[model samples]
Target: MTIDPEASPPRPPGRPRSREADEAILGAALDLLIERGMGATSIEQIARRAGVTRATVYRRFPNLTDLLVRAIEWEYQNTQPEALSWPDVPAMIRDWAGQLSVPRSRRLIRRLYGTVDDLPELLRAYDTAHGSHRGRAVRSTLEQARTTGQLPPHTDPETLQLILSGAALQHLAAYPDTTEPKDIEAYFLAVLRQVGFPAASPSPSRRSTQR
Candidate 1:
């Protein structure tokens, strides 16, 4: 799953927020989170890695949890393409599976899921901060897919989204150590079959040629 970079609204009418500092802090936090698990990554470490004062981080985010959540979401804004299009969906799916199979993404995702143990409340707060960015995009994509007959007329995007996301988490968790590409692709096909994906399912090579 991805977080929205624009999760935080404009700093109220009071003081100006430093955009440069915001970017630096979030970048540092994300790097640290990937390298170190949530339990080990600290606010002070983030501050030090970011080359900013602890006060700077606190000013941008209330605490370590907020800092971590925002950093995850911020990557969505900065790293993602301007648009998530249908033409890119197949490739995006492949890339997502690849990411899930990798070390960094696996660690970050597991860490987020594990937050329930000690920071369930903080995770809930992050859900509120998530806003409508990714949800809206997913909805729009499903609607377009439906319109194009890429999904069955009777398909429910919301339910499908939840199932796919949940299954993806399960997939990552099941292969906590390593996930083979073949395994991920098999999982991908299973998910598509369940969703009744209307397109002709192609082998990776065939898909590349088709694209």
Candidate 2:
């Protein structure tokens, strides 16, 4: 028997839904994931936390993995890095590190890393999206440094790009519970100094503080 198209059940009506609902749902999902971690979160819990029906959540996201991947993308878009200054690399690194160290963001990231083996496809997508932006930013910053003479004329931007990216990730993983922002700032500044950036100016109380 042929199915009648018009006889199919009608889509439930609402005022034309807001595109913002998608953003809201993603944001809520990320928040819940951060609060509860991966193992504890569920589709039903996310729907409840997002204040939408489970069907609505599924309509937007095919599964928990899809929801998580989209939520990570949404968070990345919301926190796009600002323009960088060549002379301010230390401060920029510190700021980026601080953003990553935030409790919720850190928790989500930790959970994502933990599940890489089980959800390689989702992890690949997450890595591609995040790595693209990070790589672009690293290249831009290094290029600007070369143009402005902050870095040596012969310094390889590509090499510096890898170095800076690896250093940032390593530091974040090593000091997940960073308490002093200044300490983080100092660590990056030390890297720059080793790479030939001039040492930062001494604080006015440097002599007293040292004693």
Once superposed on the true structure, which residue ranges of model 2 sit more than 4 Å away at CA? 1-15, 18-21, 79-88, 121-130, 176-178, 199-211
Give the C-alpha miss distance for residue 150 in model 2, angstroms: 2.5
lDDT of 1: 0.70
Mind giving the per-residue lDDT tens digits that candidate 1 earns over 83-189? 44335345546755766777776776677667778877545544544424445566667767777777778878788777767878888777654777667867876
Error of 1 at 75 (Å): 2.7
**Least well predicted 10-residue stretch by lDDT in candidate 1:** 79-88
Q: State the lDDT of candidate 2 residue by residue for 1-211, as single tens digits.
A: 9653423453567646557668778878888777776778888898777777677777777899889888877766644455333345555676666656566655666667767787665566666667566677767777677666677676777887777767766765787564466766777777776776642445779967987
Question: What TM-score does candidate 1 get on C-alpha atoms?
Answer: 0.62
The CA lDDT of each predicted structure is 0.70, 0.69
| TM-score for predicted model 2 compared with the true structure | 0.70
Model 1: CA > 4 A from native: 1-25, 48-62, 79-81, 88-92, 120-132, 176-183, 199-211
For all predicted structures, in order, the TM-scores are 0.62, 0.70
Give the range of the ten consecutive residues with the poorest summed lDDT in model 2: 78-87
